[model samples]
Target: MDYPPDRDSWFAPLSLDLILKVLNVTFFHPFIAWIIPLSFRAQTMHWDAPPMLVSIAWAACLTLAWIAGVVNHRLAYGLPRHVDLSDEVIVITGGASGLGLLIAEVYGMRGASVAVLDVRDMENGEARGVTFYKCDVGDKDQVARVAAQIERDLGPPTILINNAAIVNGKPLLDLDLAAIDRAISTNLLGAFYTLKAFLPSITSAPDGGTIVTMSSVLGHLGAAHLTDYCAAKAALTALHKSLEAELRISHPRVRAVLVEPGQLSTPLFHGVRSPNAFLAPVVEPVDVCRAVVAAIDAGRGAHVATPFYARCAPWYNVLPAGLQVVARRLAGVDFAMRSFRGRLPVGENGERTE
Candidate 1:
C-alpha cells in the first residue's frame, strides 16, 4: 500500500531534537564536560585562570546533574528484572500494520515467540516467529479466545503491547455517535480488554511480564477536529497511570510502560500535516519501535516519548488556560487535521490501521 511522501523541505529535518542530540554528546554529556577541564589542565593553564576555573565549574555541575539523574531513575523505577528475549512470548495488538507491525516483525526476526492479534490479516504477510490471530481487540470475547489460543500455542504471554487505535479527524459536533463509539471502543476500551485478558498470565509468569500502552501527545492537548480521538487517547493515558499505580501496589513484579508519540508518518494519519515540521516533525515508526523494544528488554516500567517535544507535552496542561490557548494556536494543534484523510481515501473502505 502506498503511503504519504515526505513532502518536507531541505531544512525540515533540523529540529530542536537534532540540536539537543549534538549537545548531549559534545557538551552536555558529563564525560565530555570533564574532558574540557582535563584538556585545559594538560595545556598547563593555571588552576586559577578564568578559562580553567570556568571549565572546572562547568564539568562539576554537569557531573552532579548526571549523578542526580541516575539517582532519580533508580528511585523512580526501582530495579529492572533481567530479560532474556528467547524466553519471552510477546503479543501485539493492531499488529497488522504501522508501528505495531514494525515491532512484531522486529521481534519475530529476533526469534521471540510473537503473536499478532488483529481483525485484518498481517499487512506484510507472516514473519519468522510471529503468529497472526484474526481477532478484533475491541471485542472482549475475541480477545479471550485469542488469549487462550496464544497460551496454548506460545505459552503464557510474557509481554502485552496495547497498540490498537483508530482516528476520526472530525470536530466534536461533526462526529456521529457511531464514530465516537468506534474510536473509544477500539482505542480506550480495547486496552482494558487486552489487559484483563493478559495481565493474569503476565503477573503469574516466572519472570513477570511487561505491559506497554501506546498513547499520544494529543491525549494531553485536545485538538480541534479530533475530539473523539483525543478524548480516547487521553483516557488511555489515565488508564495506563491508574493501572501502573494498582500494579505497583498489588502486582509489583509486572511492569507497565507508557508510550506517547506525536504525529507518525503512517496511514493512520495519512493526510494530517505537521503545522511546523522543524518543531513538531512527524515521528518515524522505527524510532518509537526502538524505544519500546529497549524498554521491554530492560525489563523496566518506562514512559517513552518520541521526537523531543512529546517528552515535554505534559507541561502544556500546567500552563494557564489563556496561555494554553495561545500555545495551541502557535503549535497549530487545532488545525493540524484540517486536511486529514486518515488511512482511507475520499471514498475507500476504512480498514483498521494503527
Candidate 2:
C-alpha cells in the first residue's frame, strides 16, 4: 500500500517554492556561498575584486540569517523538552482517515501508545499498537468518557493532537442554521471539549505534554462561501493564542503547536479549484502531518504553515479593506467552494455535512 512519491515530485516540479528551496540549499547556503569566494581566491583573484567582496558579503549574510533563525526559535519556544517514544502516549481526534490517520499510523508503528477517537470506524480497520475509540470530539460528554477510558487502558495521554474538523462550504445566505451550528460545534467547540477532558491528565503527567491545534489559513482571511468554516477556524486560532498565553504563565512545561495549512488535497475540499497552483499548490495531508509530528517530537511550540503562501496569509489582514477585497476576488477565495461534498451526510452520526 505504498503511495507514489507525490510530495517529493511536487516540490521538485516548477514552482516559486521549489526555486526558493533550491536556492536556500545551494546559492543561499552559507557553506556554498563561502566556497564561491574561496574558489575565486584560489584562481589568483584579488580579495579586493568586486566579485570577491560581493561573495564574501553574501556568505556572511547567509550565515547571520541562519543564526538569527535559530535565535528566533529559541526566544519564541524556549528549550525543547525530552521526548522518549516508549514513554509517550498520543491521542488524536478524527484519526479515522486523512492527515490524522497518517500520523496515528506512524506513531503506532513506532511503538508509541496511540489512541484514535472518531465516530467513524477505523478507515483501515485498526492498526497494530493503535486503539480506536468510538467517540465524537464535537460532543463534550463523549470526549470526557473516552478520555477516562483511554487513561484507564493506555495511560494518561502526553500528546493531544486536536485534528477533528468539518466544513460547510456554502454562502451565508444559502446555508441553513443547522449547517452553521454544525460547523462551529465540530471545528471550534471540538478543540475545547478535548482540552477540557485531557488537559488535567496532561498536567498531571510527570514529563509534561504537547497539544497540537489544526487550524487553517482561511481563519486569517475569511472567504465568502465558507462563512461558518472560516469563523470557526478564526475562533480556534484565537483560542490557541489565549491558551498559549495562559500556559506560558501557569504551565510553561506544557507545549502548544498551531498548524495553519492552506487548502489540502483531501475529500474535505474535493472539486475545489486552486486559483494559482504554482504559487499556492494544494498541500498533501502527509506534509502537514510531518510538520505536526516534528513539532511534537521536539516538544516545542510552533506555528506550522504549509505551501509557503499560507505563511504569508497573515499579511493580507494588514492591507486596506478595499485591497483585501480585491485580493480575495483575484485569488478566487470566495468562489473556491462552489462545489464541496463533505465526508458525511447532514444528520448521520450526529455530525454535519458540508
Candidate 3:
C-alpha cells in the first residue's frame, strides 16, 4: 500500500479514531443506548420484542460499564485533588516549540505562571504569561541553577512537565558514543534531574504538584533505527511507575502523569511516516497538549496514550517472540525509520531552532 506523503488527501480525515469517535456518541454511549430502547417503545413495540430487549440490555450494560470504569480509576489512582489555575506555577522543559510549547502557551493564556526551560529561545517568541528560561535540561548543573532562578523569579514550580527529548534516529552500532550519551542524558536522565531539583518544592507547596512525562509508544515497541530512543523511553515509563509507587506510600498528594503517544506532527520526527495512517495516525501536538492539560487541571494521575493503538501497545510484550516479529513486520515498526530525516539540532540561540 502506498502511504501518501503529508498532503491534503481526500482520505486524510478518515481514520480509526474518527470512526470510534462517531460510534462512541452513538452505539457505545449509555444515553444513546437508552434512546434506542425508548424509540422502540415509542413505536408501540412489545416489551419482550427482540429490538426492545436487545436495546434495553445494551443500555444496562453500557451504564454498568461506565460506573465500573469510574470505580476502577478511583481505586487505582486515588481521588483527584483541587486545581486552582491562579495558584499554579508550571515549569515545562522543551517548551520553546512543539508539544511542550503548545502546553505552555495554553496555561500562560489562562493567567497561570508559566516557565519554559529550553536550550533555545521560544520558537514563536514569548507568549503572555510564559517566561523563557534558557537552560539545557540535559545538564544537571543548568537544571539546578535554573530551578533556583525560577523560585526567585516566578515562585517555585507547582507542576513539572518533563518534555525535553532528542532523537539521533540511528541504529545502535552506527551511533557514536557522544551522540548516544547526548540522547540518553537528555531523553532519560533529564527527567531524573528535573524531578530531583523540583520535587522538594513541589512537596512543600500546599497545593502539591503533578509531574508529567511525555513518553512514547515506541518505548514499548522498540523500533529498528530507534535503539537509544526506545531504551530511554522504556526507562522513562519504568521511572514513572516506580515514582508513582513511592509517592503513594510517602507523599500521596503529588500526581504523576505518563503520556505515551504515537508519531506526532512535529519537526522532531519530520520525514518519518506511519505504516498505517488509519490505524496508527500521526498525533497532533495540540491533541497531546489538550490531554495533558486536562489531567493537570483535574489534579489527577493518569497514563495517557493517543491514536488508540498506543493504549494497546503494552500488550505486544505478552505475544510470542515469533508472533512479535511477524507483527512488527506487518506494522512496519522497524522499517518506519528507514526514510527518517529528523530535525537538525538547535543551538542556545533562536537560530536553527527548527
All candidates: TM-score = 0.94, 0.93, 0.95
Query: Once model 3 is optimally superposed onto the true structure by TM-score, how far is the C-alpha of residue 145 displaced, in angstroms?
Result: 0.3
lDDT of 2 by residue, 64-151 (tens): 9999999998888778877888999999998877888999999999989999987777778979889999887878888889999999
Candidate number with the higher TM-score (1 or 3): 3
Tens digits of per-residue lDDT for model 1, 149-210? 99999999999999988888877888889778878888988999999999999999888789
Q: lDDT at 162 for candidate 2?
A: 89
RMSD in Å for all candidates = 2.5, 3.3, 3.0
Clash pairs, model 1 backbone: none
Clashing pairs in 2: none
Pitting candidate 1 against candidate 2, the one with the higher TM-score is 1
Of 2 and 3, the candidate ahead on TM-score is 3
How many clashes in each structure?
Answer: 0, 0, 0
**For candidate 3, lDDT tens digit of each residue in 1-354?**
112345553234789988998999999999988998899989999999998998899899999999999999888789887789899899999998889999999999999999999886787987999999988888999999999999999997899999999889988899999999989999999999999999998887887789999899988988988999999999999999999999888888888899999998876787787888898888988888889999999999998899888999999999999999999889988888887777667665635644
lDDT of 1: 0.86
Which candidate number maximizes lDDT? 3
